[model samples]
Target: MNILRRAAHAVLDLEKARCEKTVKLFRKLGLYRRILESTGTEPKIAAEIEAQMLSIMEEGILDQHTLCSRFVRGELAFVEFVQQWKVWYAEYCSWCDRVALDAFRQAA
Candidate 1:
């Protein structure tokens, strides 16, 4: 599969909002593997993937923050939101660290 095609597919799996079927189709395209292969120590591809992953993480965090804020304003129990947010935030940070670190190494 093409690099872009694979990245698109993996992106869906990693963080898709809708059209699960379509994304699944792309998911079947072996995007994650392709992306790693495409990188092939190219550095650029690594940077690209890193950039995309970080952006996705940021968006997820922002959305979750907004939702949590809304619940707070609504005087709702935010335990669930807070818990999920903390978990996701931790995962996101881990992902961010991995990608950003790769990007940094590539830039170096």
Candidate 2:
């Protein structure tokens, strides 16, 4: 029973770490700003996005995933969203590469 409890705690910790990682990802992507700008023409959608963002900020991973999925299905122009997503992806990859190089250098 003790071992099982420890394992459960480990799992929870991992989930928390993943949530923090995802939150950082979205923050770096300026998700809130993008949602506001993209949904400007649709006040309802904009409000929904803002609500989700607030929930995610206060909650975590599950809300973040929900928000992202909702945005994908939202009324924002697909082409524009895709363009922005591509740019964000590229920047994220570059940042990852830099971090990896830094880690490698530190190890050496």
Candidate 3:
């Protein structure tokens, strides 16, 4: 395969591993339980949290789409894309952290 394709595959693998790690962390922390438990009496709170989560998730996807589009269009070099992706991923992780904190607070 070409170098670009190989790089893409390598990045994909890294992202997959990151995702798996995040899932495992969530499970270990009972993040899902905290979020779901709040739904029993406060549907509105649950709905709001769910909406926030979905919006953050969608924003990350859109950011990634834009990044890929720019790279494919030659607007950004591979090195620049990688750097921007790392920044984006850090922001995404912070968003996840906020979600986890909110979940636990709501459950409490």
lDDT of each: 0.58, 0.54, 0.68
Question: Ten residues in a row with the worst lDDT in model 2?
Answer: 63-72
In terms of lDDT, model 2 sits at 0.54
TM-score of 2: 0.40
Q: Model 1, residue 40: what's the lDDT?
A: 69
For residue 33, give model 1's deviation from the true position in Å: 28
**TM-score quality measure for candidate 3:** 0.57
Models 1 onward score TM values of: 0.37, 0.40, 0.57
Candidate 2: clashing pairs of residues: none
For residues 5-106, what per-residue lDDT tens digits would candidate 2 score against the true structure? 456556655766777777677666757646655744244444444444544354544533433443444534667667666775666556555644553354
Measured on C-alpha atoms, candidate 1 has an lDDT of 0.58
Model with the higher lDDT, candidate 2 or 3: 3
Q: After superposing candidate 2 on the true structure, give the runs of residues whose Cα lies further than 4 Å from its correct spot.
A: 41-108
Ranking by lDDT: 3, 1, 2
Off by over 4 Å in 1: 1-54, 69-76
Ranked by TM-score from best down, the candidates are 3, 2, 1
Candidate with best TM-score: 3
In model 1, residue pairs whose N, Cα or C atoms come closer than 3 Å (at least 3 residues apart or on different chains), thus clashing, are: none
